[model samples]
Target: LLLSVPDSTTGTISVTGLNGASNPSFLGMFTTIAGFEPAGANFNNHYPMQDNVSDFHLYDIGEFFPIQPVADYNAETGIILPPNPNLSGQLKEYQIEFDGFEQVHVDVFGLVTSQNGPNIRTA
Candidate 1:
């Protein structure tokens, strides 16, 4: 079961299972703000990969988010992948679940800056 599910990519994010030593190995990365996953279940080489940002964190718990946020910026765009295109059809290749669509929601968070003056923030 995932806690957060984002509709688009977070540029770069860390992926790990909810608990235990096993984590959801980074499946794929979204380069654009809006996009979709090509038809398939083999996320082995399908997920996006990226070099960790300068001290920036990608995945928190199991959700994806940017390391930093700008004032007013929003990642509200979210798309939920449905289970199977239709009823009678069993979509095994896509891994569309029949029960709870466990997913990771994406969002932006604020950060305290080092600058003495005020800093901008967004989510």
Candidate 2:
């Protein structure tokens, strides 16, 4: 049976299974062109996992050197910041699972200037 589902560009996606099941088995794969994947994965690895600024740390210091706003930063600091110069990164994609549903989030993170450049001293 075909299930009718809404087209939500950046939100959760829910679909009904053949047996009226809400959480259907799902398999997903991600592929990227030559250098894009590494670039993205690298960015993702550096991307800040914490959403709080106070959660950032650099060698025992519980604050990002020179300090930065969470709304403007994407990666963790003091871990060999990328030399992208001008400081930049992308969202690539993300997955969220809840209430028997998995939502894939994809969007560009755009761009923001880094308070501390990749060469900025963090001591």
In terms of lDDT, the best-performing candidate is 1
Write model 2 residue lDDT over 40-92, tens digit each, in one string.
Answer: 33334322222221111111111223433222444566354334545543211
lDDT of 1 by residue, 35-79 (tens): 222233222432222122111123223332332322232357554
Write out the backbone clash pairs for model 2: none
Candidate 2, residue 60: CA error in Å? 31
Give the candidate number with the greatest TM-score. 1
Show model 2 residue runs off by greater than 4 Å: 1-81, 88-97, 108-123
| Whole-model Cα lDDT of every candidate shown, in order | 0.30, 0.27
For each candidate, what TM-score against the reference? 0.19, 0.16
